[model samples]
Target: MQTKSAARNIFFGGTIFFFVIFVGLVAHSYSYIVTTSTNVKTLTEAVAHGKKIWEENACIDCHTILGEGAYYAPELGNVCKRLGGKDAVMGMIEARQENEEDTRQMPNFNIKGKDLEDLAEFLCWTSTIKTQNWPPNEAG
Candidate 1:
């Protein structure tokens, strides 16, 4: 262990061992994602589009989803259930589209029609996920 050669061998061996472990962990995580997480059947093209729309709009900046994101706005993980349904969700978004009110500074994104509907669908999809009873409140 005192010799330079022995020290180098130990360093290289540990590096390789850790690298293998990292690769194995990555593989295991990928397998779990493919086999256990995400209901792929529910991920229709519309849902993907809705997710894209959500990202583009940066809704997470304002609202929380599944206990993630900023705390500025209300948690939206179960918004569909709390608000009533997708239609109600749509109503809220549509109402915000051309909003001219001088209320809390939620800027108008002008989202309407199919785009709004698709966003609602994405929100509804999130509502149905198994969150182990998160948001803790039925009003979320």
Candidate 2:
């Protein structure tokens, strides 16, 4: 009788222990979800348009932004900050259209005006993602 009672106690205690662990893990996951969801920036129509442009142009085939896409070109995850601001990004795009010898030889997409603005906005939005300093440094 004594041995049976000890075994029963042990089984119940182990079950409770595991249940508590599972609850803690769930709570932690929920907290992370809440925090990250709140931190995410709201996507606008222009940003969506710019995202479409990025996809249509296959920009990911060359550049890696926020650790997604290809690696042939420089990481543009922080290009806005690196280049100064949105205007700088537009200027670079315009310059790429004019300059024949850009480092990567980006094709002159002739993307201009609002398209340029939208694309820059999209890139800026990507920069704001809370990736925890991904790519390690700006040189990526």
Q: Model 1, 28-116: lDDT tens per residue?
A: 98887666655667877777888889999999999888888988888888999998999999998776565557646666888888888
Query: Candidate 1 versus the native: TM-score?
Result: 0.77
Clashing residue pairs in all predictions, respectively, total 0, 0
RMSD of each: 2.8, 4.4
Q: What is the lDDT of residue 42 in candidate 1?
A: 88
Give the 10-residue window scoring lowest on summed lDDT in candidate 1: 96-105
Cα error, candidate 2, residue 4 (Å):
23
lDDT of each: 0.84, 0.82
TM agreement with the true structure for every prediction: 0.77, 0.71
